[model samples]
Target: MNRDAAPWREDFRGGSREAEDRLFRAMAQAISPRPAARPDAAPVGTDRADRRLFHAKTAVGITDAALMVDRALPAGLVVGHFRPGAILPAAIRFSNASAIPQADGVPDMRGLAMRLAIPAGGPHDFVLANFPTALARNAEQFLALAMAAAGDWETRLARLASRIGLWESRRILAHLKASLKLCPSLAHEHFWSASPYLWGSRPVRFELRPVAGEPPPPILPAPGDNALRIEFASRIARRSVTYRLALQHYCDERRTPIEDAAVDWRPRAARPIEIATLVIPRQDISGREGRWALEQIDRLRFNPWNAPEDFRPLGSLNRLRRFFYAAGDQ
Candidate 1:
């Protein structure tokens, strides 16, 4: 932690206020650092799009979807864009979580980035992941991990051991290995916010689960790099895919700490209560209109900070996310 300033401390409640500046610099360097000169070609690194620090792989699909807020929900859960009986038009992008593009067979984190078109104001974004918890606890730990990853085998191992220790590193590795296995289809997998957000005045975590009665995705004899996309296309060609959007409210600081995103609050907190539904319509994204939609979506930036004031993101990790994401856009 840098611990050199205190002015921005008020914005980040229970956050790593000291590490924010250092984290910003580190993220900027990691994403698009000045490169060594080349003999004939342009500079080694200049393109921001090509140098995205994470989740830079091809999107599995960028299609239209709708979010229907439940009309029968209790009055308390109805806040922000989740107004009862509201039908919000949305666009969703499914992606593999890797700085470099890899095959679908590879066991890695997956992402579900969504943007809702709100009639009241600007689009609200939700960046969800297949994993229920983050690998790092805060911006400082994330910076250390990123630094360690840039080193060689021996140096990386030593740095990991020293920075996060052997047991914690091993635990993260095991968790990733078990949870990030090859997905039969993106539509079947659940997506979690993993971090907290302010639901009006209260903090809450959200997730999306596939609706019941959809047939299981086929077991490919040998899945290719686009296996997930292929499965989704085949299924959507026949019928629409739907999901239940639910939220788990915060309990207490000890059980559902706002600062630590690495902790899974599901164990101690109450089960998630359903509030809305998401439906991906049966349409061809492979055709001309679909291609146009994909191109437009790829050009758009989806950040969790693009939300209503009442639904602002919480925690140090999210605070770090807000800083870096906004910085990247600039």
Candidate 2:
């Protein structure tokens, strides 16, 4: 029994013995790799279909261009909507995802997690990563990947020996191996919902795509390389680019298999993508309003399980999150 690990009793808090065992088994299966004998499947493009579907279903007055906005919810802010036309204001925080204590200029995935107060729809919260798909599908898979990446002393020594042997044996000539490092700038990177969820009346996933243009120049680390931060600040100052929230729907089962996360959604089966523009205005992070917004988002809880009755998350990851997220909240 690893003392650092969570207890089995904790896992069974509100369940019977049978249920606990089943959960443990499911967790085990999620962490294990798929057998090599199983070949990978094809990708799917569902965003196009979702766009067409959403447009067709919306009321006559709701034009595709109407969804664009010039400002986002404020930092650590909450907004409530009482009536169809009524608007309530709130604050929010935008930062890098690496958890490294640094300005937004650091090369890493852009994390967009926010909490919004809706008078009618309950609290709205979301956490998005820069990539369209997550590195792992579920919590267990996440754990396994972390463990694999965290090589022990023996593993490190073995890798070193292999490199040395290769060099001595002349097996490789001038191998230009790039070191595994996080990116410094996130401006060009697009954030994604990662997990699939039902969007409005249709089942779909969401992704933030950058407008067509070159990102700011790269800023490598140096004695005083605060240039990345400067670039980020300048971009916010100019406010040139506006992101589009593209929704993709699943149409075909064969190409866009729901069970696998590695495969991209097939474009062939994809519905037209409905786009919603998001414009972020510059705000002082140290200001009282910004602090308030950060506090609100941090204290507030956001889960896919908190979604409307019709829009449930599907697949093994969703099922696992339903249990674990609830437990963590408790």
Candidate 3:
């Protein structure tokens, strides 16, 4: 929306033109209509791990939010040490998936965007969700899915009419209809990169596992209570969770295309997880120190395209993102 600050338009040339056009079109359409809402499915299985759902209603006014990457880190876990490379100081921000800053304890898959300053090499960045895999694979698939989900009110009415017309004649039609759902509220879910990326010569993927503990205590509303703010402040004060950063690598030659986000790479050999610890220290969210830290860290941006050649993001989604994200920011 900030035309002058638009980085995509200024840098648009070479391979990214088509993606840029598609993104703009999608944004335009998304703003024009009331999309249909899908019915929630009945809870499926008894397995709590698979059936648990997290949703958070965020508070207003915070434009963006971030997690301090190193504040709770386990000692000696290195940052920026690629094979044949040296360590570098890096900063990261974690936010809710919707891009708006929300109260901390809301159920959502935390969003993490990291920026690593590479001395003598370009900075490496990433945009990630907490899941182990993604719902869609490529830019085209993602675009189509998003468009279908954003169908206007008339589109929804037409669909309903069609359903009614075939009601008596076709029971299968009812079962076959696909429902469109909005992106899950990030607070209550975990996200994944869903695509493979390079880490040195090995191909790898990342996941964010929440710290081991029961969920934070529920917030009680009072005369002046802001539930999310209070929960986040208290949790920061108590320092409740600890998450481990882990990586999975591909050893099979068949996984080399590295250009499709949809295909699951079968591992010829699997390696044990190398752990990196993340810890958050206690602090007052509104205090000067907390505010300054959050401002400096949260405002930082992470672009997956900003990596050394050996570790570059290589899939269709990554390529598409290289353009669209830049355009959106621009």
Candidate 4:
């Protein structure tokens, strides 16, 4: 084990896993009163159709991609499916991080969930967002936020203030506001894991960045509700989309705490190093293969824990996510 990771390991071992699980389960329940059901086959835009409490917006696109590890990667950085020159099949899903489907022009967080299929075990999944940091620092705070999210905007703010105090609630709201960006295209945005994960015994963060030198597509002056989807599909139809898969190694507990995810570990203590390439070839997502891919995504659970032991997620929030995702899967 990496000696530098001892503090986080000890902290994780000291926590009450059972208690955390119960808390997350309660969070899941409070977020969505409806019992968890199988992924619905209903079409997008169906009112309150999605069973997920968060990121309920239907996927814009689900397509086949390829992850090619850099051939010149250092031997020490090569582990699991990170072998040099290896090309792994990947499933990529793009969507809005909103329970209510809204116009693409509206400010909201974006999501990218990628699942890479390896030969050894279950597929490894990376659930990422455009934001580099999360609003809540721990499971308890996240539960409070979840409870607040179950209501309308006013109700959410009032509930949050009541649960976590006025000042803290306002601070979280400010974070939320800043995080909700209005990116013109999903293909042009950068996505981050936002939480630390084990990278061959070392805690690291992951990111997906658009390949350099590619000009972003033009944006609509007045975007429609499905504007983002339209822009992404138009881009895919014209040419392939490529991203550099990068990693940010942990510096220390102070700068890269494994437990606090709200901290952005960039321009401070760590720098991102490109390790692999992700290519989404030009394709017609409305075709038969595209339809099949979309169906598969609907039935899938894009949990960060759907990974090998070496890549297990770290932090209290991630631990809570395990149970929260499990509860949603029920």
lDDT, candidate 2, equals 0.41
TM-score pick, better of 1 and 3? 1
Deviating ranges (above 4 Å) for candidate 2: 1-107, 137-140, 146-185, 212-231, 238-241, 266-268, 286-301
- Candidate 2 lDDT over residue span 263-300, tens digit each: 45644665436344544455442346544544444443
The top-ranked prediction according to TM-score is 4
| Ranking according to lDDT, highest score first | 4, 1, 3, 2
- C-alpha positional error of residue 31 in candidate 3 after TM-score superposition, expressed in Å: 11
Task: State residue 222's C-alpha deviation in candidate 4, in Å.
Answer: 5.9
Q: Candidate 3: where are CA atoms >4 Å away?
A: 1-80, 83-90, 99-109, 119-122, 149-191, 213-229, 251-272
If both were scored by lDDT, which would come out higher, candidate 1 or candidate 2? 1
Between candidates 1 and 2, which one is better according to TM-score? 1
Candidate 3 C-alpha lDDT tens digits along 1-330: 222211211222235756554554454344334321111111111112111111112221122222334343333233344322233344545554433334444333455555555466555665566554444455554444444444674564344334333342133223223211122222233335557666544556765555556354444322232444455555556543444455556544345235556554433443425354433444566677656655565433445666666666656556555543333230
- Candidate 1 segments whose C-alpha is farther than 4 A from its true place: 1-49, 220-222
Residue range 1-330, candidate 1, lDDT tens digits: 113211111234334555555555455456334522221222112123444457776555565799998998777777766778999998887888876788888877888888888888777889888989887776666766767766785777578778878887777667667676777778778899988888777788899898988888767423787777677777888899999998887776766767778888874464799988998999886678877876666656677877888888887777666655644421
Our tally of clashes for model 4 stands at 0
Pick out the ten consecutive residues of candidate 3 with the lowest summed lDDT. 45-54
For all candidates in order, the CA lDDT equals: 0.72, 0.41, 0.43, 0.76
**TM-scores for candidates 1 onward, in order:** 0.85, 0.55, 0.55, 0.87
